[model samples]
Target: MERDIIEELGSLALATRLKNLSERLAKDVSQIYKESELDFEPRWFTLVYALKEGEELAVTELSSMLKQTHPAINQVANVLVANKLVNERKDEADQRKRLLRLSTKGEKLVSHMSDLWGQIKKANDELLDESGGILLESLDKVEEALDNKSMYERIRSFQA
Candidate 1:
């Protein structure tokens, strides 16, 4: 058996470990989506869901809503538009600002995935419960702490 460097490094490798775990989990769900012939990327789920709920949003608005970068959201939006999963239009009030809305295909895809999404949520809830339900609480606390003192600032201070 191989030694786990992340486990050995503990807090020193927290970010790397977290990223690895996130990727692993995402890949698992992506596999499921692919197996079901969803023709969607796992990364698109949040954006799709946001559009489904809000009906439409500008790229900047989506970036804020998803806590992601404008460029990142725009990139995904481009792909979504190309795939016909989303429609892009100039904002009526602001011609310079583009907005995104789900296409008919996107809606039908979402409707089809609703049941699978529920199952995924249930599995996540069960996993959290099995782990004493601290995962989400701990994540919330971490986010709050990070908001109070950003990781970038912390690293900069340490470097200085």
Candidate 2:
């Protein structure tokens, strides 16, 4: 077997490695959705989940709750609206603010997809268990560490 350079690079290639893994996982999930005849993207899960819980929420609120950027939230929201799975409107009291909620179609799809989501969860748990079971915890620690001090900051400090 050929030695994988990315794996060998370890933390030096953390971003690449993680991205590769993420893309692979996304492809698999997309395949699952395709097989099930669902018109959904793996990226849409977070926004959908947030809207599901919050019912009707402002774009800023969804951004904060999802820990994603306003632009990111807006991009997904637009896609959802275009797909007819979500409804978008201006806040009546604040015309400048955009509001979002699942369309009836979205609600129906959610109910239909609940079981498939459970299966995906179970599969992910098993995969995590197989991979030493601490990846998520380690990722959380890494995220918090980066939040306290970004990679750019840490890198620049080396020259001091």
Candidate 3:
């Protein structure tokens, strides 16, 4: 097997390692979406699912829900809009604000994919079990730690 420079870097390369893992999983998920004849990107899953319950929401709301930046939410929401899966409307009380709602197409897609979603969850659970079933819990702790004390803050404190 080839040597892994990122692995050799250990804790210093944690971000890269996680990113690589994410990309690999995304590739497989993207393939699944394609095979299903769905024109959705793996990245769009969260946003689409968020809108599946028939509530009008803003990009800001989606960002908060996904723990992502507003720009990221805007980018994904724009793609969903362009795909005709979501509709945008002026917020009734706030003229300058736009709210998003799932179109009939999006609702139908969500309904159609319900079974596939379950299978995907089962596959993901199996993958988690293969990895000892604690990765997600550990990730939650790491994210909480970061929220309480950011890496930059920790580095600065160490230098001080």
Candidate 4:
């Protein structure tokens, strides 16, 4: 059997390991969506779902809502616009601000995927539950601790 670098590094490689896990999971979900004949990417779901639930939202508002950087949201928005799944319009009250909303195509897709989305959510929840919810609880704790003092600052503090 080959040695696992991530397992060997343990807590010292927490960030790297978490990133690896996240990327793998995202790939799995993306494959499922592709296999289902859905023209969607897993990374786009967060913004898409937010737009589906809300009437419309400004770029900054979406950035805040999704807890993503403005540039990040804009990058996804660009792709969504190209795919004809979302539309960008100038906010009436603030011409400088642009609002985003799902296009008709987006609405139809969401409606079609509703059942699949439910199944995906349930499956994910079951997996977490099977882990006794420790994965989520521990992640929450880690996020809270990092929010108090960033990882960069913590590391620098330990340096000689």
Candidate 5:
């Protein structure tokens, strides 16, 4: 009976439902990008969006905000600078420190993307009901539990 319950929890029906939802969300986001005519990948958008709200952030600060490494942030910043979407300037207080800010073009692109996201949110609202909120809350709990469980902790307290 226990084996059967476990199998039911991992059934193909549940897998298909999760895959379908992911595919739908991806399609919606892709459509929004196509409409904006913005050639940025998702990671680029994340950085650009962060800069849209402010001006001039140090590379290390940006990396911490994005939860990414310095090298990764630098690589993306270099591409943006080369494309003229962002500008890097030397800090006045510290000549050795470089600060990053979005250029005029980048600012416009981020504004357009924000509008597109609003539209996506409206569409999603139409598709989801009150049950959706409950499901999301449950999923959040599961994710939190998983995040708190380290591999070492799991091995030391193995029950299964």
Candidate 6:
């Protein structure tokens, strides 16, 4: 079956390209993270980005939004609070519930980081264009497939 054989080869080629692209993306992210002055892990940037949309969020809400375990999110939130990047306050309606909000300093830092990221993205787009449309098209397909799958399902498929 020549058609079946061709499809198998195509799948293998796609898989190899995906792996290479993932490696490059990881390196790029590491480089970007190194540019930040904060002594925090790269994941902290996700939290910062999440808070960029609004001021206050309950700890549980943030945990859900970030798709992180409650304890893990709590630990990150605590570190942010200690660094004065985020403030914790008791909810007015329910004093027992704690709300987390970005501090003014945090907002400024996020804004600056956003600008830097935008520049990096523009540079990356230029480079991708120079490399031809193959990589960009492949990444777009991967993103669409990911959007159609659950996060865990996508991760499991990658692991396999």
Give stretches of model 5 more than 4 Å off. Answer: 1-28, 92-96, 123-131, 134-160
TM-score of candidate 1 to 2 decimals: 0.93
TM-score against native, each model: 0.93, 0.92, 0.94, 0.91, 0.60, 0.56
Which pairs of residues collide in model 6? none
Best by TM-score: 3
**Quick one: RMSD of model 5?**
5.9
Residue ranges of candidate 3 with Cα displaced over 4 Å? none
For model 5, the local distance difference test gives: 0.77
Model 5 residue 122 CA deviation in Å: 3.4
Which sequence of candidate numbers ranks them by lDDT, best first? 2, 1, 3, 4, 5, 6
lDDT of each: 0.91, 0.93, 0.90, 0.90, 0.77, 0.76
| The candidate that achieves the highest lDDT relative to the unseen native structure | 2
Error of 4 at 2 (Å): 0.9
Question: How do the residues 32-59 of candidate 4 rate in per-residue lDDT, one tens digit apiece?
Answer: 8988999999889999999996478999
The segments of candidate 2 whose C-alpha lies over 4 angstroms from its true place after superposition are: 1-3
Over 1-160, each residue of candidate 5 has an lDDT whose tens digit, in order, gives 3366445667546556677678777776776677778666655756887799866899988888886889999999999999898999988999988799999888877776787767767776766654465766676776577669954576689765
Clashing pairs in 4: none
Residue-level lDDT tens digits of model 1 in 1-160? 9998888999999899889988988999999998999898888988999998647789888898898999999999999999999999998889989899999999989999999999989988998899899999999999899989999999999999
Regions of candidate 1 where Cα sits further than 4 Å from its true position: none
Q: Which stretches of candidate 4 lie over 4 Å from their true place?
A: 92-95
Q: Please give the lDDT score for candidate 3.
A: 0.90
Residue 88 in candidate 6, Cα distance off native in Å: 0.7
Candidate 6, position 120, lDDT: 63
**How far in Å is the alpha carbon of 4 misplaced in model 5?**
17
Root-mean-square deviation of each candidate, in angstroms?
1.5, 1.5, 1.3, 1.6, 5.9, 7.3
